[model samples]
Target: MGMDVYVGPLTRYTLGDWLTVVQQTMQAAGREVRIVHAEPEPEDVITDPVAVSDAVRSWQAGLLSALGSPEGWTDEAELPYWTDKPDWDGYGGMILLAAYDEQPEFRPGTRRGLLRRESRADSARAFQDAPAYKRASSNPTKYPTLLSGVEWWLPVEVAPTVFEAPRVTGQPARMGRVDQLVVELTLLAKRLGLDDDQLGQLRQAGPPDSSTDVEAAGRFGLAVFLELAHAAQLANQPLLLDY
Candidate 1:
């Protein structure tokens, strides 16, 4: 699977708070939610509400402790190592399984699992290929290849206060704030004829013709991001993204 990136607003809330948000969001939509523990015992699922909440709270604290913010944007030495399973000293994965009446096997699995699954399905990038800075901002443009679509100005360099992830690991991680994300996204969105009305339509209709044009793909990816950014701005949170 290719890397998929996401940009949204960040929240001051700890992982525990986000879990509560997830639970409440799911419940309000009228879906069944369960927490699964897959070790110490052979069991794969835990339906008890209290047990799940406690486990999630403990894991959140541990995760926060393990992840201390990096001091500088381009300081590669400060990047944090990543692991597939950050269970906070637990063998079992803390998963949130959801299902509606029509869909039974709607298992998103662990929070990270859900992010990875969605990124794969969506094909979003942590950073778009467009130039992050004006042509004059960097070195001379004599070598056009240096500004290839694959390259980008690190979010930390452009918007350090917003991006909190220590580094870009293989998995989803925080990148930049919504205000900066929107600004970067707008560069491509405007060139592709994606105005407010079009963005709104794309949000409603989902991604359209994303495979045909790079700008279109960026536009499609931002459809969800616009909403997420708005939510983050309201909640006073920073954006999380990876590619």
Candidate 2:
């Protein structure tokens, strides 16, 4: 019912194996860690380093092929992963992005009348009043980077043709670089009174306020997205906005 953001390998096999490696590595380092795979694997299959390495290689190759052999795409050497299922639904996500598009200086409390608890009619009116770029349309160019995709955001370097590639589910996906996403999110965090250090600390913080107040929802959604973007940057992984 809400967005489930994941920062990790794009392919199922790669993700499962990568998680296996993470679990083993952490356990070996005297830390208790357990990782649940996004994709379920057979209980009989044993995932080892060799399997993980092969899976990663195959994932990289498939991505290269899908992107038509784009130059300068490097395979990452490290895996830093993160995932979170925020409480905001798809509409909430769109509204938050649209709000940001309209007002980049969005704060927790502002009399801009952009954030308020609303009835169903009021909500629909708010959506209608959003900037033209954020509305649903067949013209892709009308959408901003954050609102372009309903489901996926690839970690590949920004390229004009990258947005044209099909998602793993065979649907159209969005293209964005990790650095670009991080920049946008960092700005939003600063508007909320969080600096780089405080923003990074959000990874360990509890969930944001869940009141029906639109401003609160927007802040919580932004925190979730910012955290995911940071994770994607660190892991050199795609950002999957799973519904």
Candidate 3:
């Protein structure tokens, strides 16, 4: 399966009217608020939106605090909107990471091989041969920045981790900074020789002809990510990577 990106309130579609009511309450309060509820049953169809909102806010607050609460933080009442759906899977993500890993500029303690050019097949093989935990991005926490963590409602700022609480059921959960991710993604796009026009074309382009075209798939995935990251940054909303 592929990944779907989103930026806005968490689970706004699924909770429906319940989410609306809770969002209204949050807006009216004009300050941080929390709602408590009993644990839900396994077969429970309708979840308590208040509890969900509370969990989301609690997670956001803790993450923001950890992030030092960068500028442009806000509590806006906006519905969740689909950003982009990349035609790639976890392995595809690994492929992108592998490509970045091959770049000498991105590597640590070395500046050699800056002019080297490798094929997409080489990147695919690199991913296949490399260990699971590869230093593809400049994340201090060693997490795969864009494809794994969640970007909160704040301006772009880098951090090791954002959220401390358990993951929200189906919402964007892992904490991340949109700005730093943009920097990393932009670097990757440049390394692949993908310009703005090329990125836009790749964003609309279909998946690669062969899954073996790992570099093409990686470029397509990067295009989708850059679009969504920019949107999330501009809107000051959370960027969800729904797998």
Candidate 4:
């Protein structure tokens, strides 16, 4: 029942933190990995699926182009940070792979090997192929985190996500399951000073993938959603209203 998974509200956490946890999890598992934002785009919060896809594609392209060519594809001295340029607001996090997980290598000009091979094309093409890029993260949960207290194992399923067959290696990570996560989150709420509603709000918003199959969605949905909500709460800090 345990299906290992990466957690996040892509916007909620820093790129470093997000990537760290993700790398750790996948490294423990010794498998190819992927992370999809609960909210692929800010607009995904609305019911506009079309707009969401378009936005995600744009971001996807810009990201690859930048990573593939850190000093600017066309040889510009300064390159745009992944945050603002290309309006990083679209999509959750990125679809990353742990190419050589042993030590989280920093190969020159090689950042995201996890992205679907096709998404690596020019930014425009990545956007146009939104559906495919979106699917890249749709993988059956192999290792999900334990929520806190649940006793039984719940298979981790992240549907409409990108996946690759896991290559079990040294110190392989145990899989994360939904049932176990339910228990963990119950405890997480108390530890983090979050009530059920806070957790519920987090749980409610999940990755935008209506086209995914039923099985994966049902399993890993809540775990992934909680991560997003947590991140969103951090990234979108509420403003005080002056009376």
For all predicted structures, in order, the TM-scores are 0.36, 0.57, 0.62, 0.20
Question: TM-score of predicted model 4?
Answer: 0.20
As a whole number from 0 to 100, the lDDT of residue 81 in candidate 4 is 15
Residue-level lDDT of model 3, residues 98-181, one tens digit each, is 434544344323334575433222344244332222443334233345434343423446455444334445433455566766
Q: Is candidate 1 or candidate 3 better by TM-score?
A: 3
lDDT of 1 at 138: 38
Single out the weakest 10-residue window by summed lDDT for candidate 3.
13-22
TM-score sort, best first = 3, 2, 1, 4
Q: Residues 1-243, candidate 2: write the lDDT tens digits.
A: 334566776544243434333345678898876544444556655356555556556655676676654642333335455666554432364445445444543322334457653323223124434443344322333234555544455566634422555543344555666666676666656656766665445434644554345544455566777777877777667776554
Off by over 4 Å in 1: 1-13, 16-30, 33-174, 207-217
Reference-based lDDT, residue 133, model 2: 30
Q: Which regions of candidate 3 are displaced past 4 Å?
A: 11-46, 70-72, 75-77, 89-158, 161-165, 169-174, 210-212
Misplaced by over 4 Å in model 4 are 1-174, 202-243
The Cα local distance difference test for each model comes to 0.33, 0.52, 0.53, 0.28
| TM-score-best of 1 and 4 | 1
> Between prediction 2 and prediction 3, which has the larger TM-score?
3
Write candidate 4's Cα lDDT for 20-109 as tens digits. 334456788987555444324333242343443444335434543533423211211121111111011111111111111111232113
Best by TM-score: 3
Q: Pick the winner on TM-score between candidates 3 and 4.
A: 3
Q: Write the per-residue lDDT of candidate 1 for residues 157-216, one digit (tens) a residue.
A: 234422233322112343333455445445434544568788778667644443433234
